[model samples]
Each structure stands twice: as structure tokens, then as C-alpha cells.
Target: MSPAELAARLTDPALRVVDCRASLQSVSAGREAYATGHVPRASFADLLEDLSGPVVPGKTGRHPLPEVDSFVGKLRRWGISRTHQVVVYDDAGGAFASRLWWMLRWLGHDAVAVLDGGFAAWVAEGWPVTDETVSEPAGDFAATPRGELLIEGRELAELAPTARKVLDARAPERFRGEVEPIDPVAGHIPGAVNLPFAGNLRDGRFLPPPELRARLVAALGGTPPEQAVVYCGSGVTACHDVLAFARAGLPLPRLYAGSWSEWITDPARPTERGDAP
Candidate 1:
């Protein structure tokens, strides 16, 4: 929803707004930002405790999906009922916000949507923000895991290079295997295309749906939605690509939740450097 639309409905009792601003570089930055100011009536969702489970070192990716039963309690604490219209926003585009949007869908809640343009756009438009932390009464949210929406690195490797298209959402430098900043591995999975998530936006807001579809389809290189898989380092920003497809009015692709972090866990798995060829 646009900031104006959300502002008009700011007092709506059924809107469960969440602030998902976060930084991979610093763990506490998001919470600190939320403490300073955020969209009014918005509760902060920590990427570590709220959106992900404890990391298992080399065994699991950096940000593993939280266990559903436990996440249900988290949702209830946020007063996110199954029927509530949940709106999530973040500072860096919709990168972090899209994660929660995808999670809500995986839990079978279709009422969720990411705030286009995110917090940055809201602030730029003069929308009111509050430093007050929000707490809500318990709600009645539940989870029914949509296993089909997710794919692990092991299964992702099983797809023949001819049968699947893996879209990497990291920067060109990261996707090209020319830099190593965060992950232990530098190269991307074999046959992966560089489709950095930043391409989906223009001026922080998503491009118009038709233009977005053109961009996404061009990146897919004629691969049908069902035949494509999306990933990024530890599988966070990839959701931004997935959300872009959704906003573009296309069928969403499965996410490689373990992503490159998990892909490199075993030395036996093949890796390819340089551009997709």
C-alpha cells in the first residue's frame, strides 16, 4: 500500500503493521532504529529472533527459517490474526520487509503485503512516525507450512542445469564471484543468473507492474516461473526478488532458503565462477 493509503487507515483496528528495518552488517542497528522512530502503531520484528532461528554454524545457513510452532507464538504476540491485513516495511528498499511477506505466505496467510517503497519512502512523504513501542493483545494466528515455496541447497543441486534457472539476487560483484565479503564461499551455484534485487525498484518504490514484469522476464531469460529458483547469500534478499515477481503479477518462484551459504557447506558440490555462460 502507498503511504497515503496507509495514513488514511492508520487508525484501522485490523491493520497489523510491522517494521522490518535491519542491517546484515550490524545486528542491533534495526532495533536501535526502531527505538528512535518508526511507522506509527508498527511493532518491530527483529530479523534474528523474529524472522529466523538460531544459526547452527557450518551445519545450517546464517538465517534458518524459524520453526513454525514457535513462530506461531511470535505472530500471536504481534496480534497478527490470520485475517488481519499485515503490512511490513523496511529502510533498505523492501529487502527485509519482503522476508516477512514471504514468511506470512509460507504460513498460509495471504492477507499480508509489503509496504511498497518501505520506511524510507514513508518518511520522504512526510508520514508521521512514533518512537513509542507498540504492544498488542494476543491474537489467533496459525501456521500451515507451504513446503513447496521453499527449496534447500541439496534439492536445488538435484535440478539439472537444463531444467532450472537459479536467479541470484546479490550485487553484480558478488554474483560474478569477484568479491568475498560475508560468505565463506565466493562463487555462486552453477548455472545461476545474476538478477540483483535492486533492479526491481526505481527511486525506492517498485517500478510499475508492467515495467517490473519486463525487467523480471528479461532476467529470467525466457525461463518460465515454475522452472526458476531464486537465492542470495543466506537467502534474505532473494525474497525481494520473489516479492518483485509477485508485485509484477507473475507466479512466484521457490526460494533456496539455505542459498549460497548452504550451497558451499560441502566441498563436493560444484561451483562456477565468472558470469553465467
Candidate 2:
């Protein structure tokens, strides 16, 4: 469904609408924004808190996947049931919402979707806003993880060659190892092609399907969706790429959340310099 359609679902009590607006650096702003005003019946979910878990050493990927049981517990605590329709939104279109969308889909829930235009569009549309601080009544929602949706460092490393096409969603400079800000080391995983997440948007909103398809086709060359994986600094922005691909009717790529941040932290994980691929 479109972003506006998702917004229309806001008034539905059965739907769980979450506001995922928060910068990667500052999470407190999300709560404050929610406290001030948010879509009616919408609750605030901190990306790092509600969407991700503590970073594990060595074994898991950079933004290692959250414990399935813990995630299901969080869903239950949020009053989301298996049948509940979930719509996630953020200021940057589906940049953040796409993370929640991917997580839900990975758990085998198909009813979930990212709000197309995000909160900014909602406000622009003159939709109702509330600061009521919604607290969902607890419900039972069990989560079953789908292993195929995840790709560990080793898996990505092995697949980076002939198995799959690695797509880096960071800026060209960052991907090229020219400037490092958040990660200890810049550059990207060897063999990963650069496709900045911003490329998915045109003036803050996502590009139309045809445009997205054309851009992604150009990026992918001939590689099919199953033969591709998308990553970003901490796995947050890469979801934008995944959302774009989905919008373009392409297969969704596996996400590497621990992305560059987690990758550089481990010296054993190989690194590359300059833009070769």
C-alpha cells in the first residue's frame, strides 16, 4: 500500500502505527518528538532500542540480529499480534521504517508495510496529530525467525565473489574509504558496489516505481535480487535501498545492519581501499 494508505490505517485500532523518526546519533529526539506531537494513535520506537539489540562480539554481524525470542517479546509488549497490520514511518521516507519493515518480514509477517511519504508527508497532508502517548494493551505475538533473510560477515564475504552482488548504500566517498566518520575505518567490504541510499529518494519522498526500477536495474546490471545484499553504516539506511527495490518490484535484498560499523571493529574482517568495484 502507498504511504497515504498506511496513514489512513492510523485510525484503525487493530493496526500498530509506529513513528521511527530519530537520527542515528541522537535517539532522544524521537521520544521528544512523539511527546510533542505524532500521528494519531502512533507510538514512538527508538531505532536502536526497539529495532535493534546490543552488538555481539565477533560472531554476529555488525548490527547483529536481535534475539528472536526477545524481539517477539517486544512485539507482544507493544500489543502487536501476528494478525495486526503494522505501518512504520519516519522523517526520511522509509529509511528507518524500512528497518522495521524488514524485521517484520524476516519474522514471516507479510501484513506489515512502510509508510510511503513518512511523518513529514502526513503532516503536510493535514492528518490528525496527537501527543497522547499511546500505550498498547499487551497482546500475544510469537516470532519465528527466517534464517535466509540474514547474511553474516563470513557469508557476505564468501558470497561477495560469485554468489551475490554486494551493494553499499553509503555515500561514494565513504564507500571509497576517503572519509570515515562513524566507523573506525572507512572503505567498504571488498567487491561491494556503491549505491547511496539517497538515490532512492527524489526531494525527500521515494521515487516512483518506474524510476526506482530503472536506477536499481542499472545498479544490479544482470544480478537477480537473490544474488544481492544491501548494507550501510549501521544497517539503518540500507533499508532505504531495500525499500526502493521492493517499490521497484524487485526481490528484497538481505540487510547487513552491523554494516560498516561492525565490519571495521573487527580487523579479521578484510577491508578495501579506493573504489574498485
Candidate 3:
């Protein structure tokens, strides 16, 4: 939903707002920002504690998807009922918030939406903000994982000769192994093509449906949307592309939760550099 649309429905009884601000460099920064000020009636959701599970050495990536039961408990804690119209936002465009949005959809909840342009867009409009934190009574949200919406690194590594399109959501430099600010070795999965998450947005908001569809369709080449998969550094920002797919009215692609970080943990995994096939 657009910031303007969200602001207009702030007082609607079924509307729920979540502040998902986070910094890739520092985990505590998002909560600190929320304490300073946020959309009125918004409750903060920490990317580390609330959204991700504990990292498991070389197995789980930096932001492993939380255990379903634990995430369900969080949903209840946040008062996310099955019927609530949930809107999630973050300061870093929709990078972090899209994770929550995708997770909710993966759990079979269809009423969730990422606030286009995120918290920055809200503030830009001079909408009312408050430092006061709010919490609602526990809700009865349940978990029903949709495995089809996800793709694993192992399966992706073997996708050759098949008509699948593996899209990497990292920056071009990272995709080309030119520079990697995070993660061990640079470069992308052997056959994956680059499609930085930023391509889905313009001036902080997502591009219109037709434009997004054209870009994504062109990226997919001859592969169908169902045969497409997306991933990023630690499986976080890739959701931005998934959200864009939905906005484009295209079939949503699968997410590689472990992503590049976990894929590179095993030295035996193949890595390509310089865009050479």
C-alpha cells in the first residue's frame, strides 16, 4: 500500500502497522530509530530477534528464516490476527520490510502488504509521527508454511539444462565479484543472472505494474515465472524482488533463503566471476 493510503486508514480498527527498520551494519540501530519516532500506533519488529532464527555456524545464513512456531509466537505477540490488514515498513526502502511481507505470505497469510517507499516516504509526506510505543492484545495467528514458495541452494546448484532462471538480487559489482562489502568470496551462483533489488524501485517507490512486468519478463528470458528463483547476500533483500513480482501481477518466484552467504560456506561450491559463463 502507498504511504498516503496507509495514513488515511491509520484509524481503521482492522489496520495494523509494523515498523521494520534495520541497518545491515548494525542490528540495534533499527530499534533505536523506532524509539526515537515512528508511524503512529506502529510496533517495532527487530530483524535479528523477531524475524530471524539463531545463526548456525556454517549452516544457517546470517538471517535464517525463524522457526515457524517461534515466528507464529511473534505474530501473536505483535497482535497480528488472521483478519488484520497488516502493513510493514522500514527506513531502507522496502529491503527489510519485504522480508516480513514475504514471510507472512509464505505462512499462507494474504492480507499483508509492504508500505511502498517505506518509513522514509511516510516521513517525507509530513505525516504524523510518535515516539510512544503501542502493543495490542495477543492475536490468534497460526503458521502454515508454503514450501513451494521457496527454493534451496542445493536444488538451485543443480538447475542446469533446466529452463529455470536464477536471479541474483545483489548489486552488479557483487554479482560480478568486482566488490563484496559483505560475505566471504564474491561472485554469484554459477548460472545466476544479476537483477539488483534496486531495479524494482524508482525514487524510493516501486515502478508501475506494466514497467515492472516488462523488466522482470525480460530478465526471465524464455523461462516462465514459475521456473524463476531469487536470492541475495543473506536472503533478506531478495524479498524486495519477490514483492515486485507480485506488484507486477506476475507469478511470485521462489526465495533461496540461505542465499550466497550459505552457498559459499562450503568451499566446494562453484563460483563464477566477471560474468563469464
Candidate 4:
């Protein structure tokens, strides 16, 4: 949703705004940003605390998917009901916000949207912001996880390059194994294609649907979205591409939540360097 559209609907009681401004570099960056100032009546969702589950060291990725029941509790505490329209925003494009957007969809809540251009655009447009925090009455949200919306590492390792086309949302350098910043292993899954999430946006806003469809559909390489898989370093930024695909009117693909971090946990899996596929 656009800032103008959100601004117009701020008075609607059923509208919920979430500020998702977490960082990979610093854990407290998102909460610090939220405490500084945010959209009026907007609540904050931290990347580690709210969006991710427990980290199992070598067993899971850096940011594991949060438990469904726990996330449902947070949704209710945020006053999100079955009918609420949710809008999530962040300063770093819509990368972080898309995580919540995808998670809500995974929970079967389809009324959620990422604010186009994110918090930066909201401030750029002279929209109002406040330092005061907001607290709403507890909501009644029931979560229904779509088991089919995910692909395990073992399944991805087996079917990729044959039955499915895997897309990696990490930067070219990381995807190419030229430089490794976060994860111990450098390269991506052997058959995964590079589709950096940043390419989906220009000036912090998503590209037009035609442009996105042109880029994403080509990456699909004749595979249907339902049969495709998307991932990133720890499965956070990949949702940006998923959100972009949705904006382009394509069906949401399965997310490899364990992503490259978990993929490397097993040394038996083949890793390819450079952008060949």
C-alpha cells in the first residue's frame, strides 16, 4: 500500500500499522529506530524477538521461522483480529517489512501489505510521526500455517534444477562466493539462480508489475511459482522477492526458510560459485 492510501485509512479502527526496522548488523537498531519516532499509532515488530524463533546453532539458520502459536500470540497482543488490515514498513526499503507480510500470509491473513517506499517515503511525503508508543486491546487472531508454503533443505537439494527452480535473494558477491560476511560457507546451492531482492525496488519503492514480471518470470524459466523456491542468507530478505512476485500478480512460491545458512550445515550438499545459472 502507498503512504497516501495508508494515511487516508489511519482513522479506520481496523487498520494496523507495523514498523519493521530491524538490522543484521545490530540487534537493537530496529527497536532504537522505533523508539526515536514512527508513524502515528504504529506498533513495532523486532526481527529477532518477534519475527524469528530460537536459533539452534548448527541445526537451523540465523533467523529461523517463529513458532506459529507464539506469533499468533503477538498478533493478538498487537490487536490484530481476523478482519484487520495490516501494513508493515521499514527504512531499508521494504526488506524487513516483507518478512511480516509473508509471515501474515503464511498464517492465512491476507489483508496485510507493505507500505510502498517504506518509512523513508512516509517521512519524505511529510506524513506525521510520533515518539509516543501505542497500545491497543488484545486481538483474537488464529493462525493457520500453510505447510505447502515451505520447502525443506533436503527437498530443495533433491528437486532443484530438475523439478524446481531455486532463486537466491542474496547479493551477487555473497551468491558468487567472492566475499562472505555473515555465514561461514560462501557460495549458494548448486542450482540456485541469483535474483537479488534490491533489484525489485527503485528509490526504496517496488518497480512496476510489468518490470518485475519481466525479471522474475524469466528467472522462473518455465516453472510455475508454486513449484519454485526463494531464499536468502537467513531467509529474511528473500521475502522481499516473494512480495515483489505477489505485486507482479504471480502466485507466492515456497520459502526455503533455512536458506543458505542451514544449507551449509551439511557439508555433503554441493555449493557452486559465480553466477552460472
Best by TM-score: 4
**Top candidate by lDDT:** 4
| Per-candidate TM-score against the hidden true structure | 0.98, 0.92, 0.97, 0.98
Q: How far does residue 172 in candidate 2 sit from its true spot (Å)?
A: 1.5
- Kindly report which residue stretches of model 2 are placed more than 4 angstroms away from their true locations once superposed: 1-3, 57-62
Worst 10 residues of 3 by lDDT: 155-164
Worst 10 residues of 4 by lDDT: 156-165
Tens-place lDDT digits, model 1, residues 121-195: 889899998999897777899788888889888888788999889999999999888998998789888989999
Total backbone collisions, model 2: 5
Question: Which pairs in model 4 have colliding backbones?
Answer: none
Cα displacement (angstroms), candidate 1, residue 83, comes to 1.1
Estimate every model's Cα lDDT from 0 to 1: 0.89, 0.79, 0.89, 0.92
Flag the better candidate by TM-score, 2 or 3.
3
Model 4 bad stretches (over 4 Å):
none
lDDT for each residue of candidate 2 in 171-225, tens digit (9 for 90 to 100) = 8999999998766677888888899998888777788999999999888879888
How far residue 183's Cα lies from its native spot in candidate 4, in Å, is 0.4
